[model samples]
Target chain A: MEFLSYTFMRRALLAGNMVGVIAPLVGVFLNLRRLSLIGHTLSHVALAGVALGLFLGFFPVYTAIIVSILAALAIEKLRRDYRDYAELSLAIILAAGLGLATILISASRQSAGIHSYLFGSISLVGTRDIYMILPLALVIIAVILKYYYGFFYLAFNENEAWLAGVPVRTLNVVFMVIVSVTVALAIRVVGTLLIASLITIPVAAGMQVAWSFKSTIWLSLFFSLTAVNLGLILSFYYNLAPGGTIILAGVVILLLVLLVKKIWLLLRRDL
Target chain B: MSFLKVEGVSFAYRKERVVDDVNLELKQGDFAAFIGPNGSGKSTLLKLILGYLTPTRGEITLKGQPVAEIMDWTRVGYISQQVKDFNQSFPATVREIVGSNLYSKMGLVKFLNQELEKKIYRALELVEMEDLINRKIGNLSGGQQQRVFIARLMVNDPELILLDEPLAGVDIRAQDDFYRIIGNINQEMNKTVIMVSHDIQVISKHANKIVCFEDGRAYPHCSQEFSYDDYIHDLRRTNLRIIPRHDH
Candidate 1:
């Protein structure tokens, strides 16, 4: 109970739940567009940005946001340049990001913090981290809601969206920018390694029974928040790593949902 | 003035011209069907009219305004033949799919008002899909999905509707239903329709104008003015009989 009152624990919870909500929200669109791997690639780029920022003495999260946005634009350019080989863009950038991160981590004497960036430590989240993450989560949520119809159209059928005069090129750039921002903020809470799990696991679970697009989105957010909250509380009491615990919680819930759906189908058959 | 015009239009992929120096004109209420063998650039020409591809040589105009300068895109609706290209597992309801039409024409600011909701219902009613608004799009049959797409295109009330092989994979009964709906749109609603189809007999039965493409060149003819036998012979002679030429 005392741990709940601690500022570090409170901050971690706030940041975790925010990422919990925003990751899956953006993730639903990414999954629909078949761009889930881009999230993993951009997180590696964010890791490189964090290492570079720590080495050069800049705010790591903000530097990550800039680096991620640049990397996203490069990915977009490469995708255009090699339309048939779009996945190659993710592969190339991921390799470069890991190489740069390794070099920067070796150069910096304050490399102890790099451990937190890799696996994530709730104790590492501070007041400054809260301030940075809050605004980004809000902005992403706002944009997703405001341009909900346009983004849905783009995800469903990009060519049709273009024919409808939906400014597809500009909207695509905006979507990547949102992804970059989410990746930057999420790494601070979930770490670079497990961030993809947080983004996609809940979405996968929600998709098991969600019959409509709107329900899928809402159910994904519900599953995400449930996982994060349960994971945070259990980890605090059991002395387990929050990031892995949160992801595992999401996985457990997904398995349970699948089991329940199967049972329901069998019961209906008997009736 | 013509409702839509494509003049001296040409498109190429690295020096191999697909659509070459094509000219076409459509007026309000015109039911024009573009017929060609595979690689004859029928779909390419339709893309040019929708501004999906810019012609390498000449220009296209909509209502006396250049295609590039037209701000009122709601005046045109395009249904691509790439319906099979859509992800089958994508989650959306019929209402959501139909509602997406408002985004391109209305932009980001206007929220879904009562007027837009009513418009969507009216469009779905036109396609006779008003009852399935809440059904999952993926669960629907192919014909039903195609009708939903038509409703999606109609939500904006466009004057010129361009469809590329809309009935390609649909069953014969559904194809008949589609032709009837399109015919009603042209004759009753007085909207111009330019459809690309390989089903020569069905299209010739309904279309007032028939345009044939051969060797990257387009030959437009009034349905009453051209000889079907000559066209079939021309199509067979060029080794362009990919889809089995329909004979009268």
Candidate 2:
């Protein structure tokens, strides 16, 4: 309860919970579309952006988000060329991103306590970060609501969706940008390395019992929100990194769900 | 006079042309099936018609307009050969799958009204999948999945239906039933249907027109000509089987 009084902890919770709602919200489509790993790739791209921002003396977080968004649009365009072997584009982008990040890190030499972005620090999430996160999170939710079936159909079967006049290309670009911005902002709540876990594991856990797309979303949101809050609270008292603890909480829930499903099946067979 | 036309459509992959210098035409209410051996470019031609690939050298038109210029594809329904690409573990029910087709029209402004719900059920009933509306799509058999897809297409009541290898993994009886449903759709609805298929025998029964692809060329035939050729081919195949007569 004393932790709630701290401004930094409260900001982390607010930002983390907003991320908790969106990471898996976009994740359900990503996993269904088999683009779950794109989150990780874009986060690496975010690293390059952060390095650029550091070298240029601008706010790193803002630069990272803008850079990753541009990278998303580029990836979407490249994705069109390498349709069957779409991962080729991802590999190319990842290499370029990492290469840029390494060079910038070397040239800038501003590596002073940079683990905050690499891992995530509650104290780093300022009032301005909340302003940025809240609006972005709302936009993601609103887009999902507006084009709910379009996104679902694209995930279910993209070519048919194209014929069904779902505006697949436009939706794809919109989706990629959403994922990019999510991964970029999520770096502050969970780290660049661990962000995909928030987008993947909770959805995986939800899919165990989710019978419909709606159920999948609801179940995933439930697991994610719980894990994120639990991780924030646990980290506060136990002195652990919030990102690691949050992802670990998600992983634990996934494992427990698997265990319970297996036991339930076994018991039913016995009857 | 034609509902769809392809003139000198020479489509190539890289430097190698697949559908080369092809000319094809279909009248209104015609069910044209493309049939040929593997790598004969029937599928590529279908993709060209679907505006997926631009021809290296010619023109394709639907209803007097080039497919490239036709922006609104709502009147067109397609079921691709990549049904296998449907993630077997995706958490979508049959109702959701069929109902989602109406989203392009109803997504922004409307919820599931009674008319849309009825439309979904009617499409399902047309494909004999009404009872499984709530069932998860992944749990269905291959044949059942195809039926669900057909139902998905039927929800829109499109004027044009394109299917690529629609019966790849379906069972024998189900294949027959599939043809019946498609035949009914063709005759009763008066919709234009074009399909790429390996099952020439079954297709011949339903298709009013047959276009054979071979060696980067297309040869169009009326049902009368195709039936005669199919009979000769079947006879030759049966005669050749005499050299290795067995339970097979």
Interface RMSD of each: 1.9, 1.7
Q: Can you tell me the CAPRI class of model 1?
A: medium
Error of 2 at A104 (Å): 4.3
True contacts kept of each: 0.54, 0.67
Expressed as tens digits, the lDDT of each residue in A106-130 for candidate 1 is 9997888888888777888999999
lDDT of 2 at A169: 89
Compared with the true structure, what per-residue lDDT tens digits does model 2 show for residues A52-167?
88888888888899999999998888888878877988888888998998898778867664578788778789998899999999999888888888899899988777776778
lDDT by residue for model 1 (B74-146), tens: 7788888786578877888888888888885454562466778899899999999999999989889888889
Cα deviation at B152, candidate 1, in Å, is: 0.9
**DockQ of candidate 2 against the true complex:** 0.55
Where does model 2 exceed 4 Å of error?
A83-85, A88-92, A95-110, B5-27, B53-68, B107-114, B211-248
Q: List the candidates' TM-scores in order.
A: 0.94, 0.88
